[model samples]
Target: MADTGIPHFCNDLGVTLIEVGSKEFMCIGAKPPFDHPHIFIDLGDDTEHVCPYCSTLYRYNPALAAGEAKPEECVWHDDPEARTAA
Candidate 1:
Protein backbone atom coordinates (compact mmCIF):
# COMPACT_ATOMS: atom_id res chain seq x y z
CA MET A 1 0.00 0.00 0.00
CA ALA A 2 2.99 2.30 0.28
CA ASP A 3 3.50 2.37 -3.48
CA THR A 4 6.80 0.58 -3.28
CA GLY A 5 6.11 -0.48 -6.88
CA ILE A 6 5.63 -4.04 -5.72
CA PRO A 7 2.57 -6.20 -6.00
CA HIS A 8 1.62 -6.95 -2.44
CA PHE A 9 -0.41 -9.89 -1.25
CA CYS A 10 -2.63 -7.66 0.84
CA ASN A 11 -6.28 -7.16 0.03
CA ASP A 12 -8.25 -3.94 -0.06
CA LEU A 13 -8.48 -4.03 3.75
CA GLY A 14 -4.65 -4.15 3.96
CA VAL A 15 -4.54 -7.66 5.32
CA THR A 16 -1.90 -9.74 3.60
CA LEU A 17 -2.43 -13.41 2.98
CA ILE A 18 0.21 -15.58 1.40
CA GLU A 19 -0.43 -19.11 0.25
CA VAL A 20 2.73 -21.06 0.55
CA GLY A 21 3.60 -24.52 -0.73
CA SER A 22 5.85 -25.51 2.11
CA LYS A 23 5.93 -25.32 5.88
CA GLU A 24 8.96 -23.12 6.11
CA PHE A 25 9.11 -19.71 4.45
CA MET A 26 10.36 -16.17 4.79
CA CYS A 27 8.34 -13.00 5.10
CA ILE A 28 9.74 -9.69 3.87
CA GLY A 29 6.76 -7.80 5.33
CA ALA A 30 6.33 -5.58 2.27
CA LYS A 31 8.26 -4.31 -0.70
CA PRO A 32 10.96 -1.68 -0.39
CA PRO A 33 9.98 1.68 1.15
CA PHE A 34 7.67 -0.26 3.43
CA ASP A 35 9.81 -3.31 3.85
CA HIS A 36 10.78 -5.02 7.06
CA PRO A 37 13.64 -7.32 7.78
CA HIS A 38 13.11 -10.75 6.25
CA ILE A 39 11.88 -13.19 8.83
CA PHE A 40 11.92 -16.96 8.47
CA ILE A 41 8.88 -18.82 9.71
CA ASP A 42 8.05 -22.48 10.02
CA LEU A 43 4.52 -23.70 10.13
CA GLY A 44 5.54 -27.01 11.70
CA ASP A 45 2.34 -28.70 12.76
CA ASP A 46 0.17 -25.69 12.16
CA THR A 47 -1.56 -24.81 8.93
CA GLU A 48 -0.73 -21.13 9.05
CA HIS A 49 1.50 -18.56 10.71
CA VAL A 50 1.67 -14.80 11.04
CA CYS A 51 4.62 -12.51 10.54
CA PRO A 52 5.42 -10.45 13.62
CA TYR A 53 6.82 -7.55 11.65
CA CYS A 54 3.87 -6.92 9.33
CA SER A 55 1.26 -9.22 10.81
CA THR A 56 0.88 -10.92 7.47
CA LEU A 57 -0.79 -14.27 7.72
CA TYR A 58 0.78 -17.09 5.70
CA ARG A 59 -1.08 -20.27 5.02
CA TYR A 60 0.07 -23.57 3.64
CA ASN A 61 -1.86 -24.82 0.63
CA PRO A 62 -1.26 -28.39 -0.45
CA ALA A 63 -2.66 -27.64 -3.86
CA LEU A 64 0.20 -25.30 -4.55
CA ALA A 65 2.72 -28.14 -4.79
CA ALA A 66 6.23 -27.76 -3.54
CA GLY A 67 8.02 -24.84 -5.09
CA GLU A 68 5.29 -24.41 -7.67
CA ALA A 69 3.53 -21.23 -6.64
CA LYS A 70 3.12 -18.71 -9.43
CA PRO A 71 4.53 -15.23 -9.07
CA GLU A 72 1.16 -13.53 -9.16
CA GLU A 73 -0.25 -16.02 -6.71
CA CYS A 74 2.42 -14.99 -4.24
CA VAL A 75 2.32 -11.28 -5.02
CA TRP A 76 5.82 -10.93 -6.39
CA HIS A 77 7.20 -7.77 -7.91
CA ASP A 78 9.88 -6.57 -10.28
CA ASP A 79 13.41 -5.59 -9.37
CA PRO A 80 13.65 -3.25 -6.39
CA GLU A 81 16.53 -1.31 -7.83
CA ALA A 82 14.50 -0.43 -10.92
CA ARG A 83 11.48 0.56 -8.88
CA THR A 84 13.52 2.74 -6.53
CA ALA A 85 15.33 4.43 -9.39
CA ALA A 86 12.03 5.52 -10.83
Candidate 2:
Protein backbone atom coordinates (compact mmCIF):
# COMPACT_ATOMS: atom_id res chain seq x y z
CA MET A 1 0.00 0.00 0.00
CA ALA A 2 1.11 3.51 -0.79
CA ASP A 3 1.55 6.17 1.84
CA THR A 4 -1.63 8.23 2.17
CA GLY A 5 0.10 10.92 4.26
CA ILE A 6 -2.36 10.23 7.04
CA PRO A 7 -1.48 9.34 10.62
CA HIS A 8 -1.65 5.69 11.59
CA PHE A 9 -4.59 4.84 13.85
CA CYS A 10 -3.54 1.37 14.94
CA ASN A 11 -3.39 0.91 18.70
CA ASP A 12 -0.86 -1.88 18.37
CA LEU A 13 1.62 0.64 17.10
CA GLY A 14 1.43 2.29 20.52
CA VAL A 15 2.58 5.89 20.42
CA THR A 16 2.40 7.28 16.91
CA LEU A 17 4.21 10.46 15.96
CA ILE A 18 2.65 12.32 13.05
CA GLU A 19 4.05 15.31 11.23
CA VAL A 20 1.58 18.08 10.49
CA GLY A 21 1.77 21.40 8.76
CA SER A 22 0.24 23.24 11.65
CA LYS A 23 -0.36 22.83 15.37
CA GLU A 24 -3.91 21.63 14.87
CA PHE A 25 -4.91 18.14 13.80
CA MET A 26 -7.67 15.58 14.12
CA CYS A 27 -7.57 12.07 15.46
CA ILE A 28 -10.14 9.27 14.96
CA GLY A 29 -8.10 6.44 16.52
CA ALA A 30 -8.29 4.39 13.32
CA LYS A 31 -11.30 2.65 11.76
CA PRO A 32 -14.00 0.28 13.04
CA PRO A 33 -13.16 -1.48 16.34
CA PHE A 34 -10.29 0.86 17.01
CA ASP A 35 -12.18 3.89 15.89
CA HIS A 36 -13.03 6.71 18.29
CA PRO A 37 -14.87 9.98 18.00
CA HIS A 38 -13.02 12.33 15.69
CA ILE A 39 -11.63 15.21 17.68
CA PHE A 40 -9.57 18.22 16.81
CA ILE A 41 -6.40 19.00 18.74
CA ASP A 42 -4.54 22.24 19.06
CA LEU A 43 -0.91 21.90 20.03
CA GLY A 44 -0.52 25.65 20.20
CA ASP A 45 3.18 26.35 20.78
CA ASP A 46 3.94 22.81 21.78
CA THR A 47 5.54 20.49 19.29
CA GLU A 48 3.84 17.37 20.51
CA HIS A 49 0.38 16.28 21.63
CA VAL A 50 -1.37 13.10 22.65
CA CYS A 51 -4.82 11.91 21.66
CA PRO A 52 -7.19 11.76 24.59
CA TYR A 53 -9.21 8.93 23.04
CA CYS A 54 -6.50 6.37 22.25
CA SER A 55 -3.57 8.04 23.94
CA THR A 56 -1.63 8.13 20.69
CA LEU A 57 1.14 10.66 20.81
CA TYR A 58 1.64 12.96 17.84
CA ARG A 59 4.67 15.09 17.28
CA TYR A 60 5.58 17.77 14.82
CA ASN A 61 8.53 16.92 12.63
CA PRO A 62 9.73 19.72 10.42
CA ALA A 63 12.18 17.41 8.67
CA LEU A 64 9.36 15.57 6.94
CA ALA A 65 8.79 16.64 3.38
CA ALA A 66 5.64 18.45 2.42
CA GLY A 67 2.52 16.30 2.14
CA GLU A 68 4.19 13.52 4.10
CA ALA A 69 2.98 12.03 7.38
CA LYS A 70 4.15 9.23 9.63
CA PRO A 71 3.72 5.73 8.19
CA GLU A 72 1.06 3.50 9.74
CA GLU A 73 -0.33 0.00 9.39
CA CYS A 74 -3.97 -1.03 9.65
CA VAL A 75 -3.78 -4.22 11.65
CA TRP A 76 -6.48 -5.71 13.87
CA HIS A 77 -5.83 -7.75 16.98
CA ASP A 78 -8.56 -10.35 17.15
CA ASP A 79 -7.81 -11.34 20.74
CA PRO A 80 -8.53 -8.56 23.14
CA GLU A 81 -7.45 -10.67 26.12
CA ALA A 82 -4.00 -11.08 24.66
CA ARG A 83 -3.42 -7.36 24.99
CA THR A 84 -4.31 -7.32 28.66
CA ALA A 85 -2.13 -10.31 29.41
CA ALA A 86 0.94 -8.66 28.04
Candidate 3:
Protein backbone atom coordinates (compact mmCIF):
# COMPACT_ATOMS: atom_id res chain seq x y z
CA MET A 1 0.00 0.00 0.00
CA ALA A 2 1.07 3.58 -0.65
CA ASP A 3 2.18 5.69 2.32
CA THR A 4 -0.53 8.26 1.72
CA GLY A 5 -1.55 8.05 5.36
CA ILE A 6 -1.09 5.99 8.51
CA PRO A 7 -0.88 2.22 8.04
CA HIS A 8 -3.68 -0.14 9.07
CA PHE A 9 -1.32 -2.40 11.02
CA CYS A 10 -0.68 0.56 13.29
CA ASN A 11 -3.10 0.35 16.21
CA ASP A 12 -4.13 4.02 16.11
CA LEU A 13 -5.09 4.13 19.77
CA GLY A 14 -1.78 2.73 20.94
CA VAL A 15 0.22 5.73 19.83
CA THR A 16 -0.64 9.36 19.29
CA LEU A 17 1.24 12.04 17.36
CA ILE A 18 1.13 14.59 20.09
CA GLU A 19 2.75 17.96 19.65
CA VAL A 20 5.37 18.36 22.32
CA GLY A 21 6.65 21.77 21.30
CA SER A 22 6.42 24.00 18.27
CA LYS A 23 6.24 21.88 15.11
CA GLU A 24 7.79 18.91 16.92
CA PHE A 25 5.50 15.94 17.42
CA MET A 26 6.13 12.57 18.97
CA CYS A 27 5.48 9.51 16.85
CA ILE A 28 4.41 7.27 19.68
CA GLY A 29 3.79 3.70 18.54
CA ALA A 30 1.34 1.46 20.29
CA LYS A 31 0.80 -2.25 21.06
CA PRO A 32 3.24 -5.16 21.15
CA PRO A 33 6.10 -5.82 18.81
CA PHE A 34 6.29 -2.02 18.92
CA ASP A 35 8.97 -2.69 16.40
CA HIS A 36 6.75 -3.02 13.33
CA PRO A 37 8.36 -5.29 10.76
CA HIS A 38 6.86 -3.67 7.66
CA ILE A 39 8.69 -0.39 8.20
CA PHE A 40 12.26 0.15 9.38
CA ILE A 41 11.34 1.91 12.66
CA ASP A 42 13.43 2.21 15.75
CA LEU A 43 12.82 4.09 19.01
CA GLY A 44 16.47 3.79 20.00
CA ASP A 45 18.04 3.10 23.43
CA ASP A 46 16.23 6.05 25.08
CA THR A 47 13.11 5.54 23.01
CA GLU A 48 13.48 9.16 22.01
CA HIS A 49 11.75 10.76 19.04
CA VAL A 50 14.04 12.67 16.74
CA CYS A 51 12.83 15.99 15.44
CA PRO A 52 12.79 16.29 11.68
CA TYR A 53 13.50 20.00 11.80
CA CYS A 54 16.15 20.14 14.53
CA SER A 55 16.93 16.44 14.99
CA THR A 56 16.35 16.72 18.72
CA LEU A 57 15.54 13.31 20.13
CA TYR A 58 12.95 13.64 22.85
CA ARG A 59 12.15 10.53 24.85
CA TYR A 60 8.67 9.09 24.62
CA ASN A 61 6.88 7.20 27.44
CA PRO A 62 7.49 9.87 30.05
CA ALA A 63 7.51 7.07 32.58
CA LEU A 64 10.56 5.46 31.09
CA ALA A 65 12.37 8.78 31.17
CA ALA A 66 11.36 9.10 34.81
CA GLY A 67 12.20 5.49 35.62
CA GLU A 68 8.86 3.99 34.64
CA ALA A 69 7.90 1.45 31.95
CA LYS A 70 11.59 0.83 31.68
CA PRO A 71 10.76 -1.93 29.27
CA GLU A 72 9.71 0.86 26.83
CA GLU A 73 6.31 2.45 26.04
CA CYS A 74 6.29 1.85 22.33
CA VAL A 75 2.71 0.65 22.46
CA TRP A 76 0.47 2.45 19.90
CA HIS A 77 -3.20 3.22 20.47
CA ASP A 78 -5.84 2.66 17.79
CA ASP A 79 -7.33 5.75 16.15
CA PRO A 80 -10.71 5.00 14.58
CA GLU A 81 -11.01 8.45 13.03
CA ALA A 82 -7.66 8.20 11.30
CA ARG A 83 -8.62 4.80 9.86
CA THR A 84 -12.00 5.97 8.59
CA ALA A 85 -10.47 8.91 6.79
CA ALA A 86 -7.80 6.71 5.24
| lDDT tens digits, residue span 8-65, model 2 | 3344455456555445555667654567886677777898888888878777667754
Candidate number with greatest TM-score: 1
Q: Which scores greater on TM-score, model 1 or model 3?
A: 1
State the TM-score for model 1: 0.62
lDDT of each: 0.61, 0.57, 0.35
Model 1 bad stretches (over 4 Å): 1-13, 67-73, 77-85
TM per candidate comes to 0.62, 0.55, 0.21
lDDT of 3: 0.35
Indicate whether candidate 1 or candidate 3 has the larger lDDT.
1
Runs in model 2 lying further than 4 Å from the true structure:
1-16, 65-67, 72-86
Candidate 3, superposed: residue stretches over 4 Å from native: 1-40, 53-57, 60-76, 81-86
TM-score between model 2 and native = 0.55
List, residue by residue over 1-86, the lDDT tens digit for candidate 3.
34333322223343333222112223333333352333323444444454353233444454322222322333234556676786
80: Cα error in model 3, Å: 4.0
Tens-place lDDT digits, model 1, residues 1-86: 34432223422234567676767655666555566776767788999888887787778889876543334445544466788688
Using lDDT as the measure, which candidate wins? 1
